[model samples]
Target chain A: MKARVHVMLKDGVLDPQGEAVRHALGTLGFDGVEGVRQGKVIELDLATEDAAAAEAEVREMCEKLLANTVIEKYDIEIG
Target chain B: MKARVHVMLKDGVLDPQGEAVRHALGTLGFDGVEGVRQGKVIELDLATEDAAAAEAEVREMCEKLLANTVIEKYDIEIG
Candidate 1:
């Protein structure tokens, strides 16, 4: 099975990197870009038998190590 | 218009950050995880009248500033 985990910065957290990119984009005449928030996607290939089990494990992976709950949230997509 | 940009490290590029996350996930007993690759997603809310033009400009944004083409590739999704 394959899984994709999306980790995003919490709404109130300041994302300087994303901001910088946004500024640069605006300078290049790509206006109408309200803002940019940078997030991460982790693609995983699991050696598991059941999709349910893999989903549960990947959720743990995000909660424990892949994301910082203080400033981020994660969602998992399994295939 | 709204667009989502997915930027991924080139297959051969060395992603130390991702490797570290993989190692930590492994230590947490999430076994059978072969490896992990990390990427970024930027969701854009465009104040534009046309999707085609916005996409072309965003592609330029990726090429010039949003991602380092030396070891990255970007895909755009408009909705």
Candidate 2:
């Protein structure tokens, strides 16, 4: 099975790295870029064949380690 | 318009960060965690209402700034 997780900062959270990217884009002549939010993608190749099990396991992984649940949110996709 | 870009290392590329994450997960008792790859997701808010134009502009940004065209590949989604 394959699992993909997207970890993104929650609304109302300050994202300095995202701000830096936005500033860099402005300097690179992409002035129309209004806002930028940067996140992470984690792809996992699992041995399990069960889609439901894969999703549940990956969700646990996200809650335990992949994400800072307080300031960030994560979405999981299993295939 | 909104644009989401996913930047990932190409196959056969060495990803020390991903390896480290995998190792950490193993130590945290998630032994079934096998191959893990990490990437970046960049979300942009643009001024243009045209989805095609927004995608084109964001593609340019990815090619020129957001992604290293050498060892990384980027996919852009516009809305």
**Model 1 whole-model lDDT (C-alpha atoms):** 0.86
Clash tally for model 1? 0
**Interface RMS deviation of candidate 2:** 0.8
DockQ of predicted model 1: 0.79
Off by over 4 Å in 2: none
Comparing to the true complex, what docking class would candidate 2 get?
Answer: high
Mind giving the per-residue lDDT tens digits that candidate 2 earns over B1-79? 8899999999999998899889988998888877999999999999999998898899889988999989999999888
Q: Whole-model Cα lDDT per candidate?
A: 0.86, 0.92
- Per-residue lDDT, model 1, residue B62, is 84
- The alpha-carbon deviation from the true structure for residue A55 of candidate 2, after best TM-score superposition, in angstroms, is 0.9
Task: Give residue B31's lDDT in candidate 1 (0 to 100).
Answer: 75
TM-score of chain B of each: 0.93, 0.96
Model 1: how many Å of interface RMSD?
A: 1.1
